[model samples]
Structure formats: C-alpha cells, structure tokens
Target: MKKIEIFSHNPVLLKECVEGLEIKPEGTYVDATVGGAGHSIEIARKLESGKLFAFDRDPDAVLVSKKRLSSYPAFVINSNFCEMKKRLESRGIREVDGILIDLGVSSYQLDNPKRGFSYRHDGALDMRMSKQGVTAAEIVNKFSEEELIEILKKYGQERFARSIAANIVKRRSQKLIQTTLDLANIIKFSIPAKFRRNKNPCKKSFQAIRIAVNGELESLEIGLEASFDLLKAGGRLLVITFHSLEDRLVKQKYKIWSRGCVCPPKSPICVCGNVPLAKLVNKKAIRPSDLEIATNPRSKSAKLRILEKL
Candidate 1:
C-alpha cells in the first residue's frame, strides 16, 4: 500500500467555514468530510477542552487526517459521514456544537491518476471514494442505456445525456469500456464538435458516473439530516458544496428548516404547528474570494451555506 503523504490542499472558503461554525473553545465539533484535514486542522487548533470527530469513507483520507490531526484532540473515523449519528451515539456523543461538511472531491483524489476521478486521467474506471463496493467500470459496463441516461441527466444535468448514453451502449457492444480515457473519448465523440470546443464533453458524463458509483448525493442527503439531528440547539451546520446540484439541495433544506409554517398561503390558522428548527447564517451562499479563485482554480465553483439550530 502506497502511503499518501500529506499534500497541500487549499480548503475552499476556509475562513468562512470556520467562522460559520462559531467555534467555542470547549464545544464538541465534527468535520464530516475531513478530506486531507484541511478544515479539520483549523477546527482542531481552536479547541481547548473540546473534541473533533473527523469522518471520511476513504481509507487514504482517514490515514492522512489521523496523522495531521494527531496533535489535536481529534478522533478520526474511517466511515461515511452519513453514519455519523450512529457512530457518535456508540461513542456516547448525542449532540455536537458544530459540524462542517466540505462536499468536494479532494485535490489529492483528482491529481492522482490511479484514483480515476478526473476525466483528464486515463486510469481504470474506479471512482470509489472508499476504494470498496461498486466501481465506475461496473456501472459503465452493466447499466442499461436508459439507466445511464437517467444518471447523467439527474446527477450531472447533462443536456446531451441521451446521446452520451446511446454512445456508451454502442461502444460497449464492440469493446468493454475499461478505463477513464475510454469512456471520456466515447463521451467526447457523442456530443457535437461545437459543444466539444466550448467545454470538455466528458465532464458531465464522468461526474454522473462517479456520483452513481459512489452514491454521493444519496449519502449527502442522509449525512445532512444526520448532522442536523446531531447538532445541539444553537449549534451550527456549515456545508461547502462544489456544484449547483449539491448547493441546491443544501439551500432547499436550509429554507425548509428556517421556515416556521407548513400551512398553505390561504390558511388563516396555523393548523400544522410546524415551527422553525433552524435559521440560515447567511441569506445567500458565500463564494470564494477572487484571490482564492485565482490561486486555486478548483475553488471557483465552491459555495458555502450555513444554518444554526434554533
């Protein structure tokens, strides 16, 4: 096993995430997606008697975080953050003061060709965050054309989902799509020449396949709820999402939590008795500073949304 060295990863909106948490020196905190311990280290540093629970499905990330956070009062867990509630319960932790979730693929993963996350890479089609369960190759080869289309359209919001799906099926009929470049080429050719020139046609298709393989969105949905439920009253949940899809989910959930009424607009009385559970820390999502974007281009799409339990 190749030990992953602690490579530098610029945590997107680091200041915003930390400030949103409003860290109390003696309050418990959780870094749900502690990729490379970028945000975890900062949270750990601010703790006096408090503890930080860092969770990551990727074993490599867990190893890196464990080392990076060794100096602080942090517990590194090699499990999906969706299971955070149960895991924390096992440790006799019912609620935490704050939670931070950075829902972006780490630069380490993308830069490593063997991980097969980037469309720019030409490695095996294995985009598993945990390095376990179904690989991207299995989904690419076994899923039906319609299934592929649905994943691409729903997850990636790809306009050329139908064409991409058809091409994938057609190509797999002749030869198995075994590598990242293989599928990237198929996706590139599936779209028109003009579109290809505008942007990488494989971007959306690769993203869709990676999401499906890893169940990224499903896990995020579950993790968000778990994190919210585990937060003490007045506790904050700060999430940094990389794409519009993830941001939309976070925004809608925050809106629902911050709203007090469920009754229709025509209702004269509050029959449902639904009270607001949380309030948004910021009315709008926070974006990276221009300097940060220029220095780290990957942070360009990042958006941070925060909510505090009421």
Candidate 2:
C-alpha cells in the first residue's frame, strides 16, 4: 500500500471533532470519510477493545489509510460510506458509539496532478472519487450544454453557469477537452472579467464537475442516512462539511431528526405522537478557530455539527 505525506492532511477541527465524539475507551466508532486517515487515526487510538471502521471511495486513500491506521484497531475499507450499513452488517457491526463524516477532498488529491483532481496543475480531466464511474472529460466533452448548466447551477451554485456551459460546449466542439487546464481556461474566459476578481474562476466549475462525476451530493445523502441508522442509542454523529451546500444538507437533516412533534402548525392537536429520534449536540454549527484556519486555510470553510441519537 502506498503511504501519503502525513503532513498533507491537517485534520480539520481535530480537537473539537474528537471531543464531540465523547469517545469511551471501549466504544466502537466509524470514520466514514478517511481522506488521509487524519481523523481516523485519532478515532482509532481512542479505542481499546473497540473497533474503528474507516472507509473511502478512493483506492489511493484506502491504501494510505490502512498504512496509517495499522497500529490501531481500525479496519480501512475501499468503499463509499453510502454502503456503510451493508458493509458494517457484513462485518457483524450493527451499531457504533460514534461516527465522524468529514466531507472534504484530501489535500493529497488536490496536490497530486496524476489523480486529475486539481486545476492548479495540468492533468487529465478525470475526477472520480472511486475511479469507477464517468470521468470529467467525458462530461465536459460529451454532455449536453443544458446538462452542464444544471450541474454547475445545482452543485456548484455557479453564478455564470450558463456562460460556462455554453463555453464548454463551444470549446469541446473545436477540440476535445482533455486536461484540467483546458477546461479551466474555458471557465476563466466564460465569466465576465469584472466578476473574476478575488476567487479562482475555475473553482466552482471544477467542483461542480467533480461532484457530478463522483455523485458526491447523492452519496452524502445516503451516507448520512446510513450513518444515523447505524448509531446506537445516545450515540453521536459528528459531520464536518466543507461547503454551504453540504453544510445545509446536514443542517436540514439534523433539524428534521431533532424536531419533536410532527403535527402540522395549523392543526393544533398532537395526534401523530411522533417524537424526535435525535437531539442536536450544538444548536449552531461549529467553525474552526482562527488559529487553526490561519495554519490550514483549507479548514476556513469547514463547519462541524453534532447530533446524538435519542
């Protein structure tokens, strides 16, 4: 197994995340997204007789994680967390004391041009987290303009989705969009020069394409369900989301799970007798400290939320 640079991953919210888990020495835990085993390693060390099931869709990550977590009672699986329930069941693990899902792309992936995950360096336009589905090049070169627009708008929330999609279609027709820089250039020129001041012009489009290729949002929805269901009574769920879309999804879902009465507002009586399945550990989402963000800028956008099963 190939090992990654241990220094690559700074483990966003490391202190808050571990403390939020309220780890018991013998309690089982799950690290649903083992980007570089940063969070997984800590979770595993807290366990004595307890087990830690760490998963990642990226084979490279799985390889690196297994090596990093070898010293602890951790099982690194080469699968998406969406399959958490079935995988855990296969391993005879029905419930866990806590689960942590960090929905951020690994720094190693962004830094390695060979993986085709970064626009900063030239590489192929492939962005499959699992390396098992449609590649970004295929989407950019073959997808309809309308399809591209929809993905950019919904996933990336790109303000210039239409212009970007139109540009991709036009550029691809002249010659196939093969590399990250090729698509990045198209995105840069598509947006108005005035609007492209602070942030990288390609950031949103690149993120949208990657999300589409990996089915990331869909996977997160399913993974959240599986993770919540796999928790034992009073077991906590700690989710660290890196963007507004992801953070919103977790916030909305957590709100639903923490709400008590299901009765309609107009209908005063409480007839359904529906009770909350969980309680929010923190009313507001937790953000990284200025100190942490100053050190690891990638963590600036991170938001951590915790919910305990009721």
Task: List where candidate 2 sits over 4 angstroms from the true fold.
Answer: 1-7, 264-268
Per-model TM values vs. the true structure: 0.97, 0.96
lDDT scores of the candidates, listed in order: 0.91, 0.90
lDDT of 2: 0.90
In lDDT terms, which candidate is top? Answer: 1
Q: Give a tens-digit lDDT track for model 1, residues 12-130.
A: 89988888899999999999999899899999999999999999999999988888899999999999999999999999999999999999689988878789998897899899999
Models, CA RMSD each: 1.4, 1.5
Query: In candidate 1, which residue ranges exceed 4 Å CA deviation?
Result: 264-268
Give per-residue CA lDDT, model 2, range 1-310, as digits (tens): 4444542677999999999999998999999989888888888888888889999998888888888898999999999899999999999999999999999688888887777889899998888878787899998888999999999999899999999999888888799999999989999999999989999988988888888998888999999999999999999999999888899999999998999888889877999887999999999999999999899999999999999999
